[model samples]
Target: MPCCPFCSSDMVYPLLNTLRCKRCKNIWKEGEENPGRPAACGSEGTSLRIRKKTDPLETRMKRKLDEYLTRSKGKFCFSAMPWQAGDISQELFMRYLKRCVKDRSLAEEKDRYGRTWYLRP
Candidate 1:
């Protein structure tokens, strides 16, 4: 079995040259040395390019806040409760949150800190 270059995990069987990480969903090509070389996904008609979708400003803010909060929850992290998630008054964050509510993208709930928490459905 080949190992992945990015994560060093076993290759996604059958496709020896392809390695996928579930945690990050990052795919890499295994090289001949230990990890196999990244196999080309190129094809005659395929553009062979992956593009990131530009998230709405609000969504972007929400994501940023999520990341910040995730990292902030340390031994002495901010004690803001779940109810405080709504305290994110950034215009972009509010817009995204409204959209999430309208589209049912995120769920509303209280956090350990009694703050409001949101997640994509």
Candidate 2:
């Protein structure tokens, strides 16, 4: 557990080119002593990489949809409630959601009331 360089709080992460302390809100860079050191990152690729590709809208929606399914832990109906749509339209939403079902990236379950859930496959 690498602590924040400024506050010594155990929350530094991803070996940022300019790391920001979650607690102190200070920015820093890895020092010479930390080069090639192991970081507690879950990423399979090198954690010290300076640039990370941001997830595209579709990818982010898929990820968030998966997260929603896990949080609900059973059936999640998109129409039953209003969650963050995040620049996605109802038509496009249905398109991708159905695509996920067809491709088995997600599973579908219809409840008694006719509401549906998109579960992870």
The lDDT of each candidate is: 0.44, 0.60
Q: Report the C-alpha displacement of residue 77, candidate 1, in angstroms.
A: 13
Who wins the lDDT comparison? 2
Model 2 misplaced stretches (Cα beyond 4 Å): 1-54
lDDT of 1 at 8: 42
Candidate 2 colliding pairs, count? 0
Clashes of each: 20, 0
Q: In model 1, which runs have C-alpha deviations exceeding 4 angstroms? A: 1-59, 62-66, 72-89, 111-114
The sequence of per-residue lDDT tens digits that candidate 1 reaches over residues 1-121 is 4333333445334345455544223454444232222333432231212223365434556566577556655211232432343323444355556676688855566667676555545
Model 1: how far residue 11 lies from native, Å: 53
- Compared with the true structure, the alpha-carbon lDDT of candidate 2 equals 0.60
Worst lDDT window (10 residues) for model 2? 43-52
Could you tell me every candidate's TM-score relative to the true structure? 0.29, 0.47
